[model samples]
Target: MTKKNWNINLKEMVKVGVHFGHETKKWNPKMAPYIFKERQNSHIINLTYTARFLSEACDFVFDGAKRGKQFMIVGTKHQTADAAKLAALAARCHYVNKKWLAGMLTNWFTTEARLEKLKNLMKKKNTGGFDQFTKKEAAILRRELNKLQEDLGGIRYMKKLPDIVIILDQKGEYTAIRECRTLGIPTICLVDTDCDPDLVDIPIPANDDGRGPIRLILKKLILAIRTGRAL
Candidate 1:
């Protein structure tokens, strides 16, 4: 995109409360009444810097996905924020379940090992090995093993480093960030007001703590990716 085009889009995004930064807070009260107005709408309005960061991060993910690069969408919890779901829909990306494999990013080797065990157990059960185990033991083992297998299957979808790691909850995803850093991969995250922005390569400051902002931001990013791809 041309510089002028980018600048125009950025301006428009800012007008819509996309990237309101700390500097904007310095504006005279009369000129910045919208800040307070936005605050009343959501708790994140007070976190202008974070909102700006998230807007840029959203752009980054959209751009990268349009180029056909692989992106991984990970979140703190499953079926909660809708960030992962939006990202997957936009980029056709892989969604990593946030439970059982806590350190899937930082400790991939260990995660892989656990996944192998789960796969083996699944295979054994599939072949009618349930008769060999006591009923209670079989039930417990099956439940735990199935959860692990689901996570493993998600991880297996992206065998190598992704072009970008989009994390919904920074605190909940500490291990994912550590692993991304270790592998020299870039990250895009919705950083809460209290979070350290330096942890992510592309930090979008917002109320990473809430569901509304997360859903809104993620939906925009997915739309951007889909639109860009159509072009």
Candidate 2:
């Protein structure tokens, strides 16, 4: 099949997935029976639309990367939805770690230093120096360390604004959008029906609320990057 036809088929599959959840009575009654059938239907439509939008956005990312454009992947709260962020990294686009700590984006050198510290700690753990704590303490420390690293990494590429900003959640990343606007960069966003599309240059109307949609979108983008279409 032609690439266009393949894309159309993928888009239709997303629509079907969304339609599956339509009608409160249609939902797996085990989940939340109180919600109206219409609400459930709305949920399905949002998710399906999001999946299709993400798939297309991935194609755009691939094309842009091939042309040597800089893209930024931004998301709020959900690291699992960060498939596009990973793709941008693979494509050599500057990636802002989604868990970036406050002020890290505005202060790159400090963030890099913190990342270095985390790296050193990881190295120490790898080597024989650090004493082994109880599982609880070890787990807690590891978690804290991981958080620190995520925060530091998130803003590592902030010195230069991206040419295009791909935002997974419009409401979640208001600050990121503000920053993008300040830099006059174009934005491509996965916008839920509840969101206003005016904020984004390229708005892919879809459900920005669920993990399934996020996962599907990220997977497609990662695939594109891996295939070298994203360069």
Maximum-TM-score candidate: 1
Q: Give the per-residue lDDT of model 2 (tens digit) for 156-208.
A: 44445456777777777777776666667778876554556677766665445
List runs of model 2 lying over 4 Å from the truth: 1-6, 10-56, 68-72, 78-100, 128-144, 153-164, 229-231
Best by lDDT: 1
Clashing pairs in 2: 18-44, 22-41, 24-37, 50-206, 97-154
* Model 1: CA > 4 A from native: 1-55, 77-90, 100-103, 116-141, 150-156, 228-231
State the RMSD for candidate 2: 8.0
Candidate 2 Cα lDDT to native:
0.56
Structural similarity to truth (TM-score) of each candidate: 0.65, 0.59
Minimal lDDT window, size 10, model 2: 1-10
- Candidate 1, residue 116: how far the Cα is off, in Å: 4.2
For model 1, the run of ten residues with the poorest summed lDDT: 1-10
